[model samples]
Target: MSAMTSAKELGPVRSLVPARLDRLPWTRFHWLVVVGLGVSWVLDGLEIQIVSQAGYQSTLGLSAAQVGAVGSVYLAGEVVGALFFGRITDRLGRRKLFIVTLGVYLVASGIGGLSFSLWFLLIFRFIAGMGIGGEYTAINSAIDELIPSRYRGRVDIAVNGTYWGGAAFGAAANLYLLSDHVPVDLGWRIGFFIGPVIGLIIIFLRRTIPESPRWLMTHGREEEAERTVTAIEQRAEAQGVKLTPVPESKALEVTPVVSVSYLRMAKVFFGDYPSRSFLGFSMMVTQAFLYNAIFFTYALVLQHFYGVPKAHTSYYFFPFALGNLLGPLLIGHLFDTIGRRKMILFTYGVSGVLLLGSAALFHAGLLNATTQTALWCVIFFLASAGASSAYLTVSEIFPLELRGQAISFFFAISQGAGGVVAPWLFGRLIGSGTDKTPLTWGYVIGAVIMIAGGLIAWFFGVDAERKSLEDIARPLSAVARGVPGEQSGPSEVTS
Candidate 1:
């Protein structure tokens, strides 16, 4: 271990690491950090799409029910992994957990490719889900902490949105990989390997990225945190970006407790910041319902209402995906420039309104398959960015000590409640009846739910744009908070 500053040497003094890190200009090092860690989402999307598409093949000789069971197993694994590993991330460090999780994913996914039977595949796939689920908590915490405040919003939103890009790529890849010329058994196995191959290359990139300096400070390694920030500064200066010194007044004094109890976290979450907790839960669950309900049942809607051929569903899907991907890429900066509350409200409210209109058009027998697809593309373009911001909201609103576990708690709740329920409810809505009334009513309910999320953001949202994490929500261990307008301690926190 590196030498650390002694608390006794300068009693009650503030550490400059967080301020220094937040004030630095963007550099090559920052980009490397983004790319290296951000690829986790891509790999996750690729792994999921490949399995969903190829799992039901006749070559596997599995019944449809058995294939569906595989998906449930993966989802259950993800929820378990997030809750279990998210706590580990808070106790251990981000760098260690992120690297370990990726290794687990690579090995488990690779082993999954070698599976010859349902039991074999189930075991490895569950392990792989655990890895990706762990990555969510670790990576999001690291990204928000390490990136400069000004760039954090857009970067985080864009990175989360890249999952769609991977899905699109997977969709295209399967078109060729699953073609009749390829044997079904061989093709499905190869599809599983795609993520592992990509992951191996990304592991090398992760090697170069440094541990978050903010995390170091809270762990009582103030000297090491200073050194890490200094190295980052030296690199930025070398890249021709002039570095400005952050004043000592910007520094924060914190009490370094090695661990926080779940009981304390619950108090902080529900008792101390009840409103913010509700806001996070509302955002997560609503987006999960809207996205999962629409995404999982979209093809069935197309086939039933538009009389569209099953074979042509993928072609329609490409445009919807392109809209989703482009939303964050195009509008992400607004989350920083315009501020979080406004952007969140706009994206969520507008998408909900648009969905209402789309629902009406469909009910009226006005939209054909082509127009309906186009309409969905426009609505989801806004919805995707809002959904991505829902993640950003939960990740940022909590104290640094609880960020990982907070993410895990909300993710598990949203996935368990909304994720599990949405598909089943939507499937029932799209029952064997030829009439589209039930599904249309489902759309109206989805719209209402989204609008409710928007209203919650309007009332309870934190305007976290372009502010340090400490500025948004003080670290649980922090002793002397620095934000000018904000109060320092948990008791004094604003709603």
Candidate 2:
């Protein structure tokens, strides 16, 4: 579909770059962007999965409380990394930050493999979390900017959902790493290196992916943006995809600024788009709480409540991870087709309702480990797509100027508020011996939070499907002087 918009306020020279990029057919270039960027989530899943399982192993010698602290500390690092690098991503450009953040992860993960004590492990885990956190902001912004709007929803959801692919791989790796087949002390160290090993290979692939043209134009680099888009078009044509010419009328005229202060960005988000701010918060926090509560503590629940051996926990996790991976792969297209609001509401509502029902069965003591794992598979099958969409929502709904920062802001908030607390609380509950009552209530609470998020989406969600980012949320710098009834405000930044 053509992303042609009537000329609004004309204050400066405009380029049809966004519409041009969005109207292109899918090609090898698009796949390169998807694979190169999406692998960060998989690496994150592997890192978290390895730590979640290994912390319980005898060789690691971590107490239950200490293990929970590991999750909390890692989340803390994510919050810091997002805020710090997120700003840099906006200022310095996506390509630079993507390279830097991945380098940080590689070095940190390799060093983590050498940890002999809890504090040593904790420090590196935090550093690694920072890398993944920065990756979330930089990569999401790049993917959304680079991919055509028509394919954005499924691609984003599928890419985000690949985190579970790493989780499943981590779970499978733990089967051997935690087994008597390998030395207990050395196996855990090997687990830590898995992400870095895979990441080292992917770093080169990422180097081939270009910086965002939208970001380039917003930073007043029109020539570079043109070159980048030309290269992309050349790649598409080389791959035999017919290219459509972008119309001149689609160009947006604006004054591009070098920098926008965080304070002003905050005002733009909260002061002008309060409902969106709230919606982003609601989606992020609910998913963060539910995921951190269950995933980080799944091994403990199995060992305590179900009497599953530490070595066998990964077996349960693999199936659980598979369900999560499959969710977005199966239903992700609906976000673009059935529409964001309906699909998000459906996925969240169904997951929450199923979780509540599962909590009741868990309280009744009717579920064995197998049944419990099966139930989790069913619940998260719906939940994973919804969770992935939270990232999608934040990335797509905001203006390009603050896209990276907005992602970082909501990510930090969700992790700080929900991710940090859930693991510690759940860990304590699991540490309370064989009782399942506390954990049951935790599940119920998580369910309610998810349902509330769905309700918020139904009310406040933006209908951004198949729309250009500029159309969804007009660029901050876009002037609207001549258009009838169009008024420019402090928040309406010209880009």
Candidate 3:
């Protein structure tokens, strides 16, 4: 079906697309969505892990600060990319942006592998960050819209957590590549190729996944939305899954607008849903600061403090990555079952407290390399889930029409405020690797930030578990009783 050419021709549309999507049982199609779109996180993890390795400082003759600047530069790229592509993802469609963004990452990262100097590597790393940043907005938006409400929390968390799987893979690869087994210069360059090669496979897999029907219906492509949902229903039936009938009352009425101006979008974010805006900002910024500060400088800490050889840093990283990966996979279901507010609070609060305890132990001259890594494993096991939930929180709580842009805005803001600063600040704190005092204080600050984020979540977090997107936040385009200007409340529209 062709898209309606003029927004003037569009009218308030009553759609069962969201309901149909939310009611489907687990099927192979869902797995495809998980593997295909979710792999972007893995690529991001690989990039971060590889760049964080201590070998880069020696290989490129970069100072410790320069090594940390590598991460900061990349994060800056992510901020730019999220802001630039996020609006486009909402307007152009999730499928298109995801594919294009992945391609951008693949090409930029492939070129980065050949970098012979610090400036050269930083430039391509920035470009690669842009691609992955765009991927975060596009893929997260797509996953939330496509998955059933029953499984949305767990699936989104698990997918976001897959970043660690890529990190673990990078760590494992470095064990051999950064070792005496491979040439020093060749090892780091080869590491950059891993994500692109994996992405080549995933790009093909993503081709089989459909554009979001929820997005289609809200954007004046109602006929295409129907066809897309119908195809999905047929796929489920073919897999021997019994699909439930969607009641008419479950339908959402959306008045498709040509485009929501940025001015209007800003008002919706700051004016209409200020609390949710704060919630998103808190969750995103805290996680970004904590993760970026620690992960980006983890190898430096190991090499400088513990006398762990640059080649052996991955050994400790293996367990840390494993714990992060397992956190969401093991406990993500609680978000859907026990509830988002409680789970987020537990994860964030527990992790912060653990980090504080670990920092004390380190400060008192008690911990060796192995034990410090062990403590990180324990702390991040909870932190990882909380961080992943941060992504889930922002993606779901906003209106359907603004979902992509909402994620992008929060992500860009968080990265700009927290992510871009953390690595560079921590790098300076890790100055000369001689003073543990500065780095110890940095850890304390991270812990306090996370605890504060948890408190904000407890006070302001939306109880969005098992709720349809429309029910959580009515689309800006939605109207009540076919009245163009009247917005429907949750009670007025069921999904």
Candidate 4:
């Protein structure tokens, strides 16, 4: 359980990275990877939604379950990607695997954009889903490894936080660009193309991305780890800051083996790391259930339940997107300043309560459409703030040696379990012959899940604020939360 490595375990030093939060554009580097990843997802979302918004008549031609299958297909691919690519990256390396994932996406987007048949559409979307699955694992793990403990959550916000950015961009394309702006001939295809174009740019950025130094150190690359620490420190010092040496004690317990079998690595995830793995899985599960409910049910509430038409629904999502935008951007900062535990607990609790309020308001018809919209906006804001932090938190929990693989594992669970279920359950909820009154039940379920997620996070999730991730990755004692560990004032950060 200790993360200490022997002198012989480390590998070549690829680059020198500074470890101080203040030394470099820690936030910038943190945000860049996810923004790149999020852009692809956003464009994909927009493309998919265009199919929903524009092809509604066409979608309706299929059976209701069949309609749901289209979305499910994509989710299925994500599930596959999460499981397979997650482990692959742990073994393969971060930046390179990420580039490969992006390449996979570029191709998937192209296929989806140009698909001529319904089955083909589903197949390509599934492939794109796989790319998204891999993206979350690879990038989040990379950011988690690169960022200091202080900035883990906030920097991670760059990843989870920007998911909405993708949605917002998708929304812009859907509402402004795709809504009769592009040629009718192109319409949804234009939306799909957006991902490939943006994905190309993201792929280009991969040229400069470094592998996780922690991974280097764990693999016996102390030189790379030191380089990473140095570069980060140097950059931070250049910006007029000082760096501390990591407490020597942090790595004292890490056992060093020249190499381990991949199967052994997998066992550690389920066997030795089961507790943490469960935490990640739980985090993903909660997010999945809530998101599907929100995405799928929001439409039903407006059209089937609230009597709004499809044409007007996309525009209404504007306020929702605004809420999503502000919530994460704001929390992204708190991810560092406020710390992940408190921030997650606070938002999760507030959002759960607000969701219940929104449900009650919707049920009572307490407000006119305008009032309802305002209430919904607040709920989305709070919910997104809570949900967005999930990735940030999970990334911090994995050991550097395991960071990339850990990301692959957690994300696979998150996407496979959470992302897919949201829409599917919503369909079952709405399409189930409940006369739409049960729509309020959907909101209620979201409220309950939100509350539960917060509690789960508070109790089980490891705390990383104010400690080095190296320390946080150890057996996770209460001391990991920073009550003067074995070394007094353990942050030995110096260039």
Candidate 5:
């Protein structure tokens, strides 16, 4: 091993890496980070929208049950991937895992396009889901660590929201490819390659981005951490952006550990930081349930309830997706300015209340298909921003060492608890296409779930806006050191 690797294995070290990173002004380098890291969500959304299309059943000679199983299988892969790779990301470092994960998706999805059998396609779909799931943990950790604190909230929210853009793109692509314009066999196969083609371009761009310096500092590679920050500073100066100095008081003291045991992770999550744990789980589960329940069943509701034709349903998705896309773009800055706690509450609360009102109208037989779609657009305009913030909340609140694993765990749990159940339950409620009463109650349940999430956030949420990640949660590796006016020892739980 080299001397630098040896030093990382030694012991405690102190560095200003986080402070140095947070003090820099925004520049092209930051934009590169945003585009490179943020595209993961877009890829995920594309994969989902493509797989959900019905062309697959006719092309693969599959039953309706088998087609539904394919979607479930992919979701199962995401859960497994997040848990397995999340731990690897914490141990192996952010940049390595991100590159490997994206490559996994590229190869798996590309080969999946050529699949001739149901078994073959299912296997690759599972593998591709793993790649995207791992991307969630690795990319979120890297982005939060690399971006400046002041810009972090809006940037993360906006990036998470871009999933809708990819969804919108896939919906638009299906309009051409799935229609009679292309051969059915060729069109469905081409749909599978869309995300991989996009992934190829993003992988090249990701080559220019660096590993998280915060990850380096905590691992005892102080010299390398310093060098990385210096290079970033040089890039900012090259862009003619003046840089500010980071204060010595902003430096952190850390005792390096090669790895944190899962036991320790469990204790820290449930014991040391209980309220923050509650906050993260509540935020993630509520949004996952609401989004999955409504979005997955959207086409059914339109076709069954409103007597709309199945073929025209894809056209309605554009406006629905546009609202979701615009939400974070317009309202994301408030999370940074109005602050995380208040904005999360507002987004969740208003969206929930609006959903309840819409449910009442549907039950009373007052809404047409067009009016119903419009109401959904307005409601999710706010809910999409709130859902994106759920990811942001989980990513930012935990200690740096466990950041990736923390995200994976919550994502996995939420997927199991909310993502899996919501669709099945709602499908049952929308049964036989006759009664609006059951689905109306379903909407009320969804509304109640979201309102409860907002209330939980109001009571337990962290005031993380404008604060450095280290300030939000001290690393387990961090050593208590007395700064002149700052409180000594580990950071107190903000919730």
Candidate 6:
């Protein structure tokens, strides 16, 4: 036998996994890491939640232009972080990137908490985006490995659900942290600080999170993978739990021989996989556009049209925030049960129709405060659910080698096309800028665009519900019109 195989044989069961996590909800090592990463996503969500509030804008003395710019600047940085760092994760490994990104987030958020100028906030916001961008590629991949394949879809949904929770968490924190004790022009700064602090705390906790064993196996590190799995098993055992399936088996195999030669991500990324790329990118764009159009503009809506008192405007958001948090949870079940194509299409279609209908109510002066808020609530909540799950679908439909790069590509490209633009357009329409439109038409425009996104998804997107990522994305070596793919196991490509 070759020295390499001989070396591998010396390692304890370095072949594969059903990773018995010792009869727990999560595999022994996974529970804490997933929880930590979820908290990261939540903090990410919370920061965004604070952006659109009147309290935020008023404190910063921001024009509509500035608000849009902040979102745009942040997204622009996200693009850099996502594209530059995502593929690097394959080379440098997941744990290193996770820790680095967390650091960036903490520093950005720390300075943002003390910002005196809007421009400084924008700069800090951009840095925060870098952290967020880096988090997705590393953390999601980390989560993918820690959990069993069966739990992927649900965990994917669950991870994203934290963003919704973050929204509420941020809003609530703002209500408490900023309550009665106003920061003279520092309310939003203080709001932005919360996430960074939490991210810093998690960094130390995240240190305990291991590198992906799957990744290690592929990289020709059998000893490391075996050692890592053993550590995980031992940890779980100490917790009075034994890994179910005993963590390793002879039946499963890791025959990968990846090297620098395998680094041509372009072929894997740019080949017939265009359909997957398109699906992923389109999902992010559509979701980002739909979300920012409303979320980043919500406070403006209340202040402009509803005639709600300024001091109490944050209170009005409690129900909406709660619904936003729950929307994904309520609707995410549909993804697994109903199938990807159907759930996304159905939710987006309904959300579009609702957005248009709500706009009509506002435009016609036909909506009373009660009716208006209720409709907005329903529409935004539904939109949030569908939009929230967009990343989950995108992330799951790519192969392991390129998954991080693929998601990062989408996050960057789509945000440029849509996400960063939505708020500016809304601001312009609302005349928050020097020239604004009536609030009524803003809703109409958002509704129309969303409907278009839904139709596009229904027509072109592939179904990912029952199939594993590899299976659904198979024949991805070539892109097609997305002709219905067969729901089969991932074509075993010997890596």
Best model number under lDDT: 5
Ranking by TM-score: 5, 1, 3, 2, 4, 6
lDDT of each residue in 284-328, candidate 6, tens digit only = 777777677776666666776667666666776777766766777
Q: Can you rank all candidates by lDDT, best first? A: 5, 3, 2, 1, 6, 4
As a whole number from 0 to 100, the lDDT of residue 479 in candidate 1 is: 74
lDDT of 6 at 69: 74
lDDT of 4 by residue, 315-355 (tens): 67777767776787765677567666677778888888887
**Residue pairs that clash (backbone atoms under 3 angstroms), model 3:** none
Q: Candidate 5's residue-wise lDDT over 245-267, tens digit each?
A: 77778788876655788887898
Give the 10-residue window scoring lowest on summed lDDT in candidate 6.
478-487
Q: What lDDT, from 0 to 1, does candidate 6 have? A: 0.66
Runs off by more than 4 Å, candidate 6: 1-14, 18-29, 51-68, 116-122, 176-180, 183-189, 230-264, 432-445, 448-463, 466-495
Which of 2 and 3 is ahead in lDDT? Answer: 3
Q: Each prediction's TM-score against the native?
A: 0.95, 0.92, 0.93, 0.82, 0.97, 0.80
Candidate closer to the true structure by lDDT (higher is better), 1 or 3: 3
Tell me the tens digit of each residue's lDDT in model 3 across 1-495. 222334446767788999999999989899999999999999988888777775667878999679868877888888888888888999889999999999999999999999889999999999999999999999999999999998999999999999999888887887777878888889888998988999999999999998999889988899999999999999999988887688998887777765678787888888888888899999999998999889878878998888899767777888999999999999999999999999999999999999999889888889999999999999999999999999999999988878989998999888886776897799899988888899999999999999999989988988889988888888877778657646664331211
Model 5: residue 330 alpha-carbon error in angstroms: 0.6
Tell me the spans in candidate 3 whose CA falls farther than 4 Å from its real position: 1-7, 54-66, 117-119, 430-438, 482-485, 488-495
TM-score of 6: 0.80
Please report the candidate that would top TM-score against the real structure.
5
Q: Any idea how many clashes model 6 has?
A: 9
- Candidate-wise lDDT, in order: 0.85, 0.86, 0.88, 0.63, 0.90, 0.66
lDDT of 5 at 399: 91
